[model samples]
Target chain A: MTLRANNIEHFYGSEHILHNISLEIMPKKITAIIGESGSGKTTLLAILSSLLKPTRGTIYYDDILLSNIKNIDLFRKKNIGFVFQFHYLIDYLTLKENIALGALKESDNIEELIKTLGISNLANRYGNEVSGGERQRAAIARALVNSPSFVFADEPTGNLDTKNAIGVFELFRNFKDTSFIVATHDKKIIDYADIIIEMEDGYVKNISSQRT
Target chain B: MITPLKALRKNKFKTALIFFSMVVAISAIFLISAISNGIVGMYSTMLKTDGDIIVTQRGIADTFFSDINYTIKKRIEKISNVKEVNALILGAAPVDNLPIVGIYGVSENRFDSYKLISGIYPKSNEVIMGQKIYKMLNSPKKIVISKKEFNVSGVFKSKIGFEDGGVVMRLDDGSKIFHKSTSIFLVSLKDIESKNTITDINHLNSDIEAKTTDNFIDNYNQFKIIKTSSDVISALAFLMGVLGIVSMMSMVVNDRKVEFGIMRSVGLPSKTIIIKLVAETIIIAIFAYIFALALSYIVLEIIQNTQKFQGYINGEITFSLGALIFFTSVLMAIVGTLLPAIWASRVDPMSLILRGAY
Candidate 1:
């Protein structure tokens, strides 16, 4: 699947945050969006994830316009996943319940995903009781537990230490069948990507292929 | 919904505060209703007597203002079924700074209901006192009534509280002191034709009002007015309880803004979020009612055991009254919670996420 945004613009009140941005994201490939703080990377990511509507321009998923999708929630649930900067796990629920929340069908590989994330032992612990890195891993597991075709992550490793950050990126690389769109300032994430889009002043300054 | 319940359990103090608020409001209402009913019961007991018929001024419920003329009494005595007729002079006077002490003067012929416990039958310058009045006067041998020094000829015990702290004097002496002709006429019938005597007396004169004891009880305006006014006040209190819940539930809904946002972000639709909030509120309502009833019952038991309200509330808390109050509280909880819960469901998910609320 290919997700495309053309001339996307977003405004917060009177201030223009994103200006005439366009990008193409492909399936089974890692796309990195890198920018400084307040450069609107998060807003652009949100617009692309179908969570927010752009003030101008259009977004298409496999040539199907996102605005035309009548039930956007159902589409996002089945096709796209989101990993926020904060884990956003319900504190009352155990890690396993949080991860399995994305599993709409019984066939979804929840237990295997928990094992792959090496959080099988931490499954019964609440979000507040677990370590930060483990919660981030559980969040990742949550995004992938539904077997979504694409996952959008905003600074997934921003709170993780060097060792844990490397582990998260490596885990992202292991998803051979899932596409990723990651917004980050981490050099490690940039190096691990198949394509990099550098954003400056709310514009896409450069898009380079690194998969050769 | 389960998660909301878990959150409530974790916030134990908050749960307790909400529960206590409900308990206080419900119990306050229950106590008011019980006391009102108690007073009504005491009034009914005081009015029970052997007299079959009573005659007074038309449309007058209070005997203090209700005067049956001597002519009317004589006419009622001539009625065929009438066996005996006794007139009473009712008044209130301050005796030794005790303002509004009930004073009733009856003919010596029908003084069977009240017996002298201490001295003798009250003569012209003598008075019989209830135990409460005797205590108030410090059991004085000589007591002043209506500015005239009189000897305390006797002390009597009456079941009615009003009569218990009152004075009774001879009819001629009462007439000169209170300056009343006659307040009421009590009539006894030869047989079971008490109803016919009342109709015949009323027919003799349009200014005369006559009724059997049962009829008088049913038509008494004081009891009817008090009952109606208390019920209205009880309803208002219930409304206030509902408003209390509205304010509390609104605060709860506002405090969970972040939680609702996160649920929406997880692809849980607004309907599901609303369902969870409603379910959580309903659970709280049911639990609060159970707790309130239990607490109220315990408090009522403690009160019934105490000397403060011992004579008043002899009967247990009536079941229908308690049930009505509980039903109103449940209504208050549901109506109060539903509006705010629906509003919480419409909260913007992106704003909460962007603000880093979760």
Candidate 2:
């Protein structure tokens, strides 16, 4: 399903964070939201994920008006996924349990996801015990565990080294059928995006479609 | 579940402090409740003597010190449903300069309930001393009755409060020794269903107060317990228990803010997170309860062995059914955790991700 944010305006208290932001995130494609610091890239992404309510305008997940849905949790859990810059894995849980949490239902293939993330050896380790790169991979595995229709990642590769960041970007690109909207300042990720949206001062500056 | 537990494990010192605080609070409640129950049980059992009806003089001020005339005893025996009526006289008497001996006037035939440990019922003006008091008086060679000496018949075991501190004698000898005409009466009813019999007896003599023995004993025991400072102790115990639960719950919830935030960001509802927290608190409380029981028993045992309280100071510790303590502690923990959990759930994922707080 295509994710659309139309003329969205967001405010925290009385301070406006995003103003008249509009964008469409296509299914089976990767969309990058690029902006300088304080450009409201994260705020815009949060509104799309339903983690933050927009003060004005509407969001539609395909034909469903997300703004009108009463139980955003059900919609978010069933269709939306999130990957944060820092992995917020539960420190008490093993990597496998942390990944499986996103699914909300236990599956034997949770170990397969851990293995695919090259974190098989770290499966039994606590979140705090793993390296940052391993933690990021585990975070990705967690986001994809539910096989959600869309994923919203806020600077997922921001904390990683060049090699680790490239690895994560490739992982994002490999999920061919799942749509992704990544908010970041990294130009390297812009090259891999099917669509690029630029933001300035909480407003969309430009939107471009890249020919693969 | 994993997230919260991990957070708890990571901050081992903080978690342990919170856990210990919870244990102390829960244990305090458990200990107080157990001791209160133990003391009440002991007193109630003492009041459950074999008599169905016990008659005491009306408006005599002090029932223990009131005198029931021998003629009145005969009159009570005439009432229907009253199979037998026995007069018992109780007073304080000095034993070997120790003001601890209780003097009892009992009939020879109905003295079997005393369960003579090493002596027979007094035959003549002889007297039987309680084992504890008998031992305390260094097992006196002879107990003087009506200024006449009689050999100590034997030590007897009694579960009654009056018997706990002294000796028993025949009513005739007791009256002459105390220089009083008559005292208390213990009446056994053949059938408790005959409530009208007591009313009729009361009507027959407005000056006489005839009551079901159970009610009399209950009232008497309740009066004694209230007078003996048990009520104050029980109230204080209950208050401490409530406070302990509240304190523990607040501490645990306050310490786990980030853990709760992690759970919320993963799509768990605020309610689900609360349930888990309450469940965890209950589990902790259960552990504390067991610990409290053990500790109370140890304390009671030490008190019994060292201080030697005459009343039931050390009985088995018992927790109330209906999961009252468990539910109360859990509820307190939930209330304690609620605000913090809500605040944690409301944390914006953007702030958490951008600030790298998680």
Candidate 3:
């Protein structure tokens, strides 16, 4: 079973943002989306995450069509995770509380999860009190804590410095069994990819395979 | 649920701003309501007396303007179930330079209703004054009325605001001073037979009007005008409070749109998000109401200590009115917050996510 988008098209009030976008997200693989600004990378990520519906397309998770599901939130809770450029950690919450916020299903060993993310020492601190890199790690922990099948990240290291960016990219390398669909512009992020999807304007410009 | 509280805590300045604004708005509403209730309560208590019903000139809303003939009093006395009818000369006496003083002329039987706090009832050519009037006269031993010097007989107190500032004199003297006829006739019915007595009194003459004491007290021309205007103003104040809350809620919702977006993307259902927002609003409302009630009490106490509202309240407070004020404040909060929360929840997460590009 895999996540597939077939001939997905999207419009922002007649301005074509995504034109005939089609892709397959396979299991246990890291797929990287590389593009410049306004190239519709984030838009495609949003549509594929089912946070949005494409204007013209069909999205299938495994054998089930997304539109046929009665509860989209429950589906996303069970199957998808998201990490954004700014982390968007809730300012008032401690790191543990932030990570546990959307964990609808049980996961094995939350302590281990925070420990693995290197945020155990910072767990009691509020999101804003931590450094940028720490907040990004906390965001990743939150997305992965519920043990979703796929994690989608949009410019996950955009705000971090080179060292922190490399740290974040390397963190993705350790999760080879979990599918990652990341939209980014950082070449360092692209180096760790198993599959590279390059987009220009609203169309696929190139698709390349990486040795990993 | 916890998210909203956390958000409020995080935005300390905004939360405090909302709390303070609501406190002020709710306090205004409480003051308006309390004042109106106080006025009505004082009047109602003052009007409560030995009379079961009252008779005055038809269409004369103010007893001071009433000129019911003495014949009507005699006629009412003859009616069956009539216990006793007491006639009064209600008028005002002029001071040398001060405001005109309310004067009530009564007999020994009518004088029993007012508690004489100090000294005896007024002797011939003497007058018992209310505490307010005594203070105004600087505790004078004697005062002049209509070119005659009369001794200050005593001080008396009544629950009624107007009566608390009045001069009580013999009916003959009141007539000589004000130069008017009988103003009002108080009828005490025999053993709970007030309805039939009132009907009998009404049939005696079309020129005379008869009504229960409660109705007469509530329908006083001055009280009616003041109550109507106060009620209208209080209603307006309540409306303005609701508007203030609505404006505040709009700002809160606008500022928290991204938070809502983040929650939505994290798979929080819209219903749950709305619930959390509404819960936060209710918490704020409850706190505001409590603070407003306490503030209103303090302000009312201060107002009572001032000479302006000394006799105006007369120790009469209505809890139902307080409850009404609280209920309205809470309702305003819910209406203000719920609509905006729903709107914020419906906002597209993608739009909010896209908005952060800058």
Predicted structure with the largest lDDT when compared to the true one: 3
> What stretches of model 3 exceed 4 Å from their correct place?
A13-15, A53-56, A63-70, A105-109, A173-177, B1-5, B74-80, B89-97, B143-150, B215-228, B308-310, B313-317
lDDT of 3 by residue, B214-316 (tens): 8887677787786788778877766776777677777876777666777777777788778887788777878888998889888887876566443555333
- Kindly report the docking quality category of candidate 2: acceptable
By summed lDDT, the worst window of 10 consecutive residues in model 3 chain A runs over A101-110
Model 1 CA lDDT for position B202 = 89
lDDT of 1 by residue, B191-249 (tens): 96676777898898887788886678677887788678778877776677667767776
For each candidate, report its DockQ versus the true two-chain complex.
0.33, 0.39, 0.61
Model 1 scores a TM of 0.73
Model 1, global lDDT:
0.77
Tens digit of lDDT per residue, candidate 1, span A148-174?
A: 788989899899998998888899888
Worst 10 residues of 3 chain B by lDDT: B308-317
Task: For residues A1-212, write the lDDT of model 2, one tens digit per residue.
Answer: 98888889988789988988777888888889999989998889888987767889999998899878876666676687788777777767788877876575643557777777799998888888888899989888887777778888889889988889889889887777788899999887678788899999998999999955
Q: What are the fnat scores of the candidates, in the order listed?
A: 0.23, 0.35, 0.50
* Candidate 2 residue runs with Cα over 4 Å from true position: A104-109, A209-212, B1-36, B59-67, B89-110, B119-153, B158-183, B217-255, B312-358
lDDT of 2 by residue, B1-358 (tens): 4445555566666456555655565555555555556555554453345567766778664555667677776777787778877777766666555644567777554577678888677877577887766766678878654446767787787554346556788888777777665665677778877588788668766667878766765566445664356446544544554455456545555555545545555666667666776666555555655665566567766754441344334344544522565665655556655555555556654444444453
Q: Rank the candidates by TM-score, best first.
A: 3, 2, 1
CA error at residue B149 for candidate 2, angstroms: 12
Clashing pairs in 3: B46-B160
